[model samples]
Target: SIGNVLLLHDLVQAIPGEVVRWALLSAHYRQPLDWNQSLLDQSRKALDRLYGALHRAAGVETNGDEPPEDFLKAIEDDINTPGAMATLFALSSEIERAMTAGDHGVVARAKGELVAAGALLGVLQSNPAEWLEGEVSDALRIEVEGLLEQRALARASKDWPEADRIRDRLNALDVVVMDGPQGATWRVRT
Candidate 1:
């Protein structure tokens, strides 16, 4: 009989299914997984970082590029998931560099490769916007949106104090607002 087993239902109840899946795949298949809260937390953060990258590259159009050769080799070599995951983050770093250099073509290619690699690992399949949004309630989302709108208006009107106040309010609600060339985008603080 199984002893001290953690049920999938219990895990999914505590965190996102994708996060649980990520944690499960973090180790080699041949290795015994030392399941714990720390592993789950780390998995959640790692996924968040990946999703955040995709979110930043959302405007770029993917060019249908394949996953990098290194990533493919890692997966093919004894199903090295950890190595593949490392390659995905490397692709994410490439995306960041491309974005910083304003090279949309490279960003598009890297983003596509990252997504394809993630598909092989059964992760990062969720829409970046939706994944980053997590399980926030509709009411909370509406409230955050309203506050963001108000902050935008304040900034447009050069009302620095009002804008600061609105930003502070958002911080209190665990919402982080980022001002980009397009406008302000908000995400829940992890």
Candidate 2:
């Protein structure tokens, strides 16, 4: 989720039940979905702030956050960076402005920017192991090399169990080991 508060607010609003609180308590901290008093207050305040901004932009709630064409270009350039996610929020303001003025160009630009931002986000968050050359890291390379050596020795000694064990260990670490005519080849599992 982009922000813990935003995600939680969305969930609570969508599903009104007491069991959700229990689920939040049991979730891992990395998947932070808890709802504290401050977050609740902040969520409410955020809604108010958004309403005010929209009201100011259009005498009523109009188009949501959308970016202009120029803004989309910048979003494309830096969307790989983690900070770009938050920067995209500005699109909401631009959308409201465009709607208030009935500017088709601005609306189109904002739509393009929103699309580019979404695409960039998807690409950045996708698996990055496919393009590696030698290895993912020095440590992982060393570990896999050691395992491959052990695998070879096990095969020579006719110890199929040992060779299988080595492969299992590598598999647990997201490394797939393949035995081929040239020897063992390994690649990271994306």
Model 2 ranges off by over 4 Å: 1-135
Candidate 2 vs. true structure, TM-score? 0.31
Name the lDDT value of residue 115 in candidate 2. Answer: 41
Model 2 Cα shift for residue 151 (angstroms): 0.7
Q: What is residue 29's positional error in candidate 1, in angstroms?
A: 2.1
Tens-digit lDDT string for candidate 1 (12-110): 897888899899989999999999999988999899889878888899999785888999998899989899999989988898788778899999889
Question: What is the Cα-based TM-score of model 1?
Answer: 0.90
Candidate 1 global CA lDDT score: 0.88
Clashing pairs in 1: none
- lDDT tens readout by residue for model 2, 21-82: 32332233345455665544443333333333332333223233443455455446633232
